[model samples]
Target chain A: MKAPAIDKKVLYAYLEEIKDPEIPVLSIIDLGIVRDVVMNEEGELDVTITATYTGCPAMDMIAAAIRVEMHTLGFKKVNIRYAISPAWTTEWMSKEGKRKLKEYGIAAPDKRFSIPADGVECPRCNSVNTRLISEFGSTACKALYQCNDCMEPFDYFKCH
Target chain B: MSESLINYTLHLADNALILGQRNSEWCGHGPVLEQDIAITNISLDLIGQARSLYQYAAEKMNAAAGKEHPAVTEDTLAYYRTEREFKNCLLTEQPRGDWAQTVLRQFFFSTYQYYLYQQLQQYADTNLAAIAEKSLKEVSYHLRWSSEWVIRLGDGTDESNRRMKEAVNELWRYTGELFVPAPYEKELGIDPGSMQADWMKKVSAVFEEATLQVPEKIFMQTGGKTGVHSEHLGYILTELQYVQRTYPGCEW
Candidate 1:
């Protein structure tokens, strides 16, 4: 017996509904962790993902979430694979992702790979008057920043 | 599974694992809140690298099983291994003295790793190469962060300068083992000896900027690469492996 095939577009829609465990405001699709999703010849869904950094603890949670979602959607045998070659960079974060992060109180990473000399624009008051409190923030993928105007501390999605 | 390959892989894993553990000690005790988080983040990166390398080594160990070989997992490789079986460099196993000592040790090791990983990326082993490539980015960040700190501390206050200089002198001896090419490292195309000149050059440049003097003594320490480690490693393993040893097969 053969199982019906899943439309790739529909698959992404389901995956897009799954937000990042850390930054719940942004979905995996927006975070650029989901590299590829395709149906194998055996009717199994193969989902490829990349970790944000070398030892991100969120990777396991993301994998588990994907498996659960697939199973709930009747994907009896979904294969989740990790791709590490072309390492995930902040450049992969979508425009929508950046907006959502800002809306949720985190500054987005710039396109540049190096740390900015001044500081990322503060997410709280949208103030340019900010200083980097630390190169690393509450998480590995973020840096701590403080806005001089509003005097609010926030995390900035770091440029990997 | 090639025994030499497994050993070589463990060498890399042990260094990352032990160093990560040392850094993790500063989790909430960093000099400042932000730097505390920063060091811990770097610790996470190193620990993650260790896990990947250990997983690969465990796969190799299990694949070459005979009647005498036991089942291997990341946990087993990390916790079950005796102190005599660890192959990390001595520098990584040293006690994290003060902030200066910690940063200087990290600077030394990160500089070595930055060059080492660059070469390892081109090694014949694809998995090892991938791991190297992945780790290089994080290690580069570590190198940059620690380098800036070295210069800041060295050129900062008089007390800081004295402490930084003392740290440099004390930690310089442990650096020799990094460049000594072990038998397996050589076979795997890891020419550690060749990296020494570049490592020294990079260190010297940083030292020059920091306005600190590099120790004139060329005498070096060795032995960690071959599983013989300092007294510090035993204490580290005691705490690191405590949960695993106390409750075998423990999991969250």
Candidate 2:
């Protein structure tokens, strides 16, 4: 018996259920890593994803998650493609996603031109006394910053 | 006309590829979840560098050969080549001595790569410049991570400091391979001599900050660029090339 066909809209909804294992607050779709989804003429499903960082360890797990999700949803012919060019940038992050990141205590990347090289405003306290501790944070994509006002160490999503 | 450009590219690629493979071996064995993720992240970055370099090499070879799709893609060139044909420097191919050693090797290599890529960004070749520009950002983080670990290990305790010092000493001999100019590199427009001085300065600063003594200069090990390599490379190739060698032309 042939497997049931899945629509792109339904596929997206299915994908929305897959949360980034590290940051459960953000869904893969919400993270903006899911670039595009297409159903080929032959009925095969193709999903394209761009990694937040080239060295992101999550890509493999993410791919497996997509495959497993689609399989359970009854799509047997699914292909995942990695798009490396034009590279993944923090700029692709959605507004809602940024809100979720901030809510989760991770400072979202600020407007690129607004912040000077010396420092960025504290996301928690809105204080300008924040200091740059390190360019790398807990993860490859985030920068470590300590807010003098809040006395909190937070991960700032580095603007690519 | 300079083979050094190609040799340098290959050396950089080899370091990334081999070290990446070693790090990937830690996939299921990391001491903790965060550390696992971090090591794997480094592996991914190195593999990405390997892919970029291999692709560039393939492109150059294709142009030279006048072939539509060069006979070998990066993956093939990466996995299928024999030990002697591999061009990674000796330092990267060494056994991961321990957590201390592994971190030290990473710190040393990343610091060196950071300086090299920063200089390469101003290379005469635009493509090389572009690749260097992209890699510099990644290597910068790598250097940061490594440097942090160096300080942690060196300043932590008696045992930690001793282990950190040992790691540095063991890996010191291979450090010279990073700066020595291959003949091809000298002929090509790429000159790494000045860059070597810059790299030493950066490395010394980091070492000083970590309160670790920088090893004095010693005789350097060579030969990866000339296709001669250490014994370790053979075993590395066996694992890396297994899939490609088993099923020639196989693709996902």
Candidate 3:
């Protein structure tokens, strides 16, 4: 007898438990790294993922986490496939993920490239008086910004 | 055909890795703390790109050669390759002479990559196309950032302009090697030579705004593509492969 196919809902639930190694507040599902999930002919789960950035060190950790999570979910074997086309964008980040990032003191990716007349809003003080400190930040996926009102340095997940 | 494809992929990976290593030298030595972080961050991205390409190359090599014991891996390909086996362009191996040289080198290379990746996104090879698509986004930022610096340096004060001009005179010769495709690149389906007109147009536009001249009639240097690199590559490999050479299979 073949193993029962894991439903999409259950698969997502399991994936949601695996938070980004770098941004613990955001789960891979909400972050849009989890693209698609399917069951292969052998009744084994196949998960497709895309890298947020080319050189994200967290990728390996995420893959390992997936294996561990699948094992706990009673799936003995899972195939993680990486897809790079139709490249990942900030738009894929869930609304809840953005909220969590803001609450975590890191600004979620902002879609607008043009600087508003007001300024970038600070995740901490909610003040639209922030300035870009550097085009890059602590990680390859973020840029450094400073809150003029709160005077705190923060990382902004780059819009890429 | 497959051999050419592997060589072509390795050529690109080597370009990214060597330039990334050179850029990382500015880690503590950047003109400013923020800029220092910026360059190194770019370096990380480049190295990240190298890792992906190397992984692809290694997979292809393993599949083709069917090696069993001591299976081929990205590390072995990166750390164990001889200097003559490197396929990076000569321009990437050039020393980071000064801020101007560093910035200019990045600007030129990023511009080339921007166009190259754009063309590659539609390539017949799905894997290469995917890598190009993923890389184009990061390359876009690098191009914009470096171009801005080029303008700033070229149009800045007399001293700054002098240094930028000096960099141009020294580095312009290496730019030619990028467009002249080698045997491997020729077999890879796309013609970098065809993109030269557009590349020159954008570069000229940038230099014009900066009131700088794109040196005319310089003797263009070539030969890094065929593993005929200058003295710089050996030095880079010595430091880069040292840890791996000293301790085989050392995990970081």
Candidate 4:
């Protein structure tokens, strides 16, 4: 049986439902991985995502999850393409998304392009006194850091 | 000179090749899903670096042998060689003891690589310099990640501190090899001496933050550059080569 037609708006909503497994509060759309959602005349849904890193293992899972979620929502023909160039940067994060990250205890990345030569600032207390603890944090996309003021260790989304 | 250049390149490639294989083992076994993905990311980066270095070395070998593309590509050199023929430094061959150990390993290796690549960026050879310039950025992040973990684990609770110390002690012996200049480095005009002091300064600064003592022992285990390797090399090669060995000349 042919799958029922789906609209771009509905497809986007369905994608919004798929949250980042790491930070559950943030959806792929919020993370900027869900680039553009388009529905072709054939009723097929095409989703483009930019991976945080080239070999990010989550790309496969994320793609599969998107497909499964869309199929469950009645869109069977789903195409997920990974856009490598123009690469994903922290700049893609939405303001609301940054706030969600702060609430989650992880610091939102510095929006400024001219990142200091020393290191990034701590998201928790807005302290540049912070120090990078590890490059490989809880995830590939984050680096471990400690806010000296808050005295709490947190993950900083490493700018690609 | 070319011989030593090949040797030095193999040394760099082996560290990355072996460590990448080890890190890949954590594909599904990471403490957390995010951590698992992170380790894989690091693994891919190291593997990519290894491939680039190996390809360059292979090209040099082909030129010396008066052939195009040589009889073997980088993969052949990486997988088909015996343990004794493998030239990665001793530190990379060490087992991934735990999360602490793995982080410590990354810390030490990345720190050295960051400085090494930075200096390499000035090499007279344009291709080598270009590769170094590109890799420096990636290595910088790796170093930062490793350094952050060192501080966290070192200053953490008694259990973590103890584990971090133990990990450092276990890996310290291998640290010596990083500074020993391979003959090819000198012959190729890649004097690593300038970066040695700088690397030491940065490494000590990180160690201080971690509250760990830098082991003062001067003796270092060597031989990777000369194709003499540790016992672990055999097992590492077997695992790394299994697929390629089973299907020679296979391409995806």
Q: iRMS values in order, in angstroms?
A: 1.1, 3.9, 1.2, 5.0
| Candidate 4 stretches greater than 4 Å from native | A1-160, B68-70
Candidate 3's TM-score on the B chain: 0.98
Chain B TM, every candidate: 0.97, 0.92, 0.98, 0.92
lDDT of 1 by residue, A55-93 (tens): 899999999999999899888888998887777888888
Candidate 4 accuracy as lDDT: 0.76
After TM-score superposition, the amount by which residue B31's alpha carbon in candidate 2 deviates from its true location, in angstroms, is: 3.5
Model 2, stretches more than 4 Å misplaced? A1-52, A56-97, A100-106, A110-156, B2-7, B68-70
lDDT of 2 by residue, A48-106 (tens): 98777656778879999999988887666789987655456667777888899888888
Point out the worst 10-residue segment of candidate 3 chain A by lDDT: A111-120
TM-score of chain A of each: 0.94, 0.86, 0.93, 0.83
TM-scores of all candidate predictions against the true structure:
0.95, 0.72, 0.94, 0.65
Put down candidate 4 lDDT per residue, A1-160, tens digits, no spaces.
4445666677677888998877888989889898889887777888998766544567778898898998987775899875544546677887888899988888777745223233456666777777655556766677677766776778877666
What is the C-alpha RMSD, rounded to one decimal, of candidate 4? 8.6
DockQ of each: 0.77, 0.20, 0.71, 0.11
Highest DockQ against the true fold, candidate: 1
Selected candidate, larger DockQ, 1 vs 4? 1
User: What tens digits encode model 3's per-residue C-alpha lDDT throughout B27-119?
Assistant: 999999889988998898899889889989888888888766557788998999999999999999999999999999999999999999999
In every candidate, how many clashes are there?
A: 0, 4, 0, 8
Model 3 stretches astray by more than 4 angstroms: A39-44, A114-118, B67-70
